[model samples]
Target chain A: MSFEKQKTDYMPVELVIGQHRGLLHYIIRPIVGDENLVDDCFSAVTEIIVKNYDKYDSSRGTLAAWLTKVARNGALSFVQNKKYAMTAGDRQDAARMEEVADRKTPEDHLIQKENLAELKEALKSLDKLEAEILLRKYYYMQETRQIGAELGLSERAVEGRLYRIKKKMMKKMGGAIHD
Target chain B: MTDFNEIKLEELLKETLPETSLAENLGVINPLGAAVNRVIAGMVMTTITLNFLGLNYILPTVGIMLIYLGMRTLRSGNLYFRLGWLTALGKLMLTTLNLVLQVTPYVSLMDGWGLWAGQAVHILFLLFLGLGIQKAGLDAGMTNPKMPTWPVILWQAVLIVLALTGINSWAVLIFMIWAWVRMVKHIYHCAADLKQAGYVVPVSTVWFSAKPLLLAYLAILLCVMTGASLLVHYTPLDAEKLVLAEAIGVKEETAEIRSELISKGFPESVLDRILDEDLADLGSVTDVDVLQSGDNTSNTERMEGYSVSVLTEDGRVKTFVWFEYVDGKHAGLVDSVKIQYDEDQVTTDIKGRLLYEKKGETWSADVKFEEKSRTYLWFGDITEDVWSISKYSFPFMADSPRGYFTWWTEEKDGSPAYWSFNNTVFNCLRTPLVLPYVELPENADRLILFGGFGSSWGQDKFQIYATAQFQ
Candidate 1:
């Protein structure tokens, strides 16, 4: 009833996962298109959520939002590992992760993190509508038709805006991106 | 080449975007935005006067629905929000009934207390809604969450006080509008602040989305309003079977009365179709004179007018302006006729009837007249004056249309009051309804009348006339 009383009732990780499991499933389903793998990716996302539950700071963001980042990353990694396994004679899980670790150097990781911070700052400078379109396309992994429908634009218009936005970001990042 | 893929942009942007923005973009509920909707709905539902195209009815319905939906989203956030949702539902029902009643003429006749009660319920709805929002912000650990709510309530109180005091001035109106704008901005800012603080509420799934629901409501309301308008467009008439026998008997009894009026120089065309009750009232019609009777020199239409005098049982002589249409072609072409009188003239009880030929016999059916009055307020005085004009629809092809008249006070000079005449043949397909444009009286303090305010009350000698010819 009281504000102090409510403050103590911080949400537990299980409750967070329980309430927003549908959201995590939505995020995972797109990347791991296979339904069976989607379930496996969601199970992996739950593991990450529990392991990092203590690190979640209420001041930083919401549980739903934090869970979203964890789910997206977990699902992407699961898909990459699955793809690598297919070419590597269906190698088991730990061997795939070790191979992925070998591909990126520690120095490379540091540079990428720094560049990401700079790109984040550049993103803040983009117009609000452009930022929304970019986030919906890349961050939320929404299809062009879905983005267009939500924003009341044609698919071609959304695609055009996305191209322009990506070009703008590439310039702002000092052409740091390359194939 | 950079080791970081472009896909890392999602990760970077995830951290960069505000939590509420991220949550909302991801299809999560923003409690503050829902609360702001309630504030906006409060503003919308209170406005009832700007009714062009029925916006007053429409906007309030939308506003009530927004409040209901907003409360539903926030109901899980706090107990106050649950109560607010119930109140919003009640307000929606009351508002819907009031809107339906507004389309009927009887709403004007209803007591003012019901309106006051509705206003009270609306205020309660806003109060609970605001409190719910404020409390939700506090529950979310927002600093100074009472903003917007307190300011909005203050402005609402000021407006209520101003309305109660009956202070009418442009300055006060401007100040109130400014306050409303400020309140709306404050509500937006408060919602933004709470959203930025990462306050999200669980949203209940709705069966129908907002736009479809609003469109459906508007469609229903428009249908109801149009149906109500059509219902009141015509006056109620008796079945043909019930009035047929009475009509036959009245014709026999009124034969002597009709002969007397004809001998006194009344037109036989006008006297033949007068209802027996009306004829009985005109029994002592001491005198009759034809004011105008002839074909127009410039046109094919024939015009006939009469002045009839009757001594009331109370012994007061009331002269009546009457018209008779004997030309079958003119009677067939005419659609509607209007009568007008000056503000000083005492005229009431306008009556009209259709005279049509069926199976080689002339028959009559009672037609109703609609009167519209224009009021003129005098300069620097509370005394108001009124001018009147009346019109009737001609539904059938009458062989001869008759019995259009209004009682009028005789002119002071004992001269026959003049009735002006104008005629137009309009293509019904191109122009369905024809209305005359009459200029208003020129007075310095008189309100400047605009287009379509053209129903005119003619010259000082109590001039009366019937206008409008049809094709």
Candidate 2:
């Protein structure tokens, strides 16, 4: 198809999110503390995809992966910026985050921030297959069986990928994450 | 109430992002862009390896291509800035040395040095690459360089272990491919960081264009190495000449040879008599036949067919010279000498006197008697009393055969000399050479000429005897 034709035929945010919601859930699940606010991240994730729809390029990655990344980035931005965040279990998570922050040196905190930025850069360096797999596993939060179906792999293969992404995360953390 | 609220919120996102056919309209991520660069890197590295074996002819050409590749790698941030240049330089140095060794007459020496330098440069390339990687990390805004520590150290260790244990080249190739992949991964990250920092990177494309040039360079290198080896196959003898000269304890030049001989326990008058003879003429030898057998196996090996003999006037110093070859090329001369001193007894005894000495006064006879002496010695009645083999076999076996003899004597330490041939207790007498430095007994009454004479292929032995009468 022509470039213009492809660009005009953009996939809507809802359908992309519908397919990859499970992936997005799992990526934010570790930091997500609120029962009521779990789905709140989804709205922000969807709105970010819709707002940045023109920037989404298929030559870079798949629609599902792009949506998942947008979702992941938006939710992370919310967690960091504390925007639209209300008290379901958000207060308890904030308390936990603060408690953890108090133990680490400010220098370590800065290092972590720097590492987080590099991790985003490392994401671009990943091969399309690895990037896609990471997106489906951590961002979409799908079960191994469902991700296996989407990627045309066995459940065990998808499980193996879960371990690999964990390693990738650790690498992005510059070996700071022990477990 | 929170769970009910979350369910309500989930209903909203699902309604918003429902599955649509628009997913099919999106452009696909092309794997080949990154893949093309990988192919170029692999081809360039293989080219580097082939040329690094010292193929000098096409090395500069390949080096240029590698520099281009290196520059591209640098532009893409796939290579650390300075290391790309160093790798190219190291490879060129190794390849040039390999080529020089092939064409030069100094093959043995250069080859030894090249081996050491090749391995040393290879390790240095790795070091440079590591430093380059560190630089790339610093540029990428890393607080501390997260150079994939385990992979780099562990993989190089694996390569070393494989090399030390004599692993096959295939295992090395496999490891290289793995290393290349991992290296590309690291470079991709660096490149990505650079791209984000507003750099316009040039990556390798046009894959098929480079394949033939690299392959052609390899083919040319192979042909040159083969041709050069054949052209210089005999060059190793240059080194071997020094070895031969050292063993013989003499210089190869005629004047130096004479001096070295006289200096090293040899009498000057003996050398004077033989130095002007045809025996001193030098000839390049292609083969050797061990005409006489003795305990000098090592000396026999160095015998390159050119043979010389000298006898001292006192019938004591005997020297034989032979030529030697190294790496199928003509080398130098080696000398073997036998010296006898008069005592109560010599090395061999016969009947009741020393085996080969004039017992009293000399019995004079015309020398150079090649015809009658040979006729009577082999076929005529001279063997009537001596043990003679019944000649009934081949024509060449028993016939009018010829041999020569010489006898020289002085008052034990005379200057002038003659040549004769005499084996030890083993019945030599094969090639006639002078036995030098013999002192006659005070009451000696007889003479024995060439005591070690025996018929070839038969045990028929004879010794021409002359009575030496002292008034």
Query: B-chain TM-score, every candidate?
Result: 0.54, 0.30
Report per-candidate DockQ: 0.08, 0.02
Candidate 1 DockQ vs. native: 0.08
Say which candidate scores most in lDDT: 1
Candidate 2: docking tier: incorrect
Off by over 4 Å in 2: A1-179, B1-72, B75-79, B99-113, B131-145, B149-209, B233-471
Give lDDT per model, in order.
0.53, 0.38
lDDT for model 2, please: 0.38
Worst 10 residues of 2 chain B by lDDT: B348-357
In terms of docking quality, model 1 is: incorrect
Best by TM-score: 1
| Residue B365 local lDDT, model 2 | 17
lDDT of model 1, residue B236: 32
Compose the digit string of candidate 1's lDDT tens values, residues B1-471: 132644554454554454324334444433244445554665656553563443545566777776666565556556766787887788877776665565454554334766666766766766776676666556454545663467766776786787789988999889878877787677666555434332434334444444455668768865765455444332233212224346632666667767777787766655554566666555454544344333321111233455445433333334444554435433221233434444434455555554444445655555555555555556865443333333333444434444445454433444443322222111110011111111112211112112111122211111223321111
CA RMSD, predictions in order: 13.3, 26.0
Mark the 10 consecutive residues where model 1 chain A has the least summed lDDT: A1-10
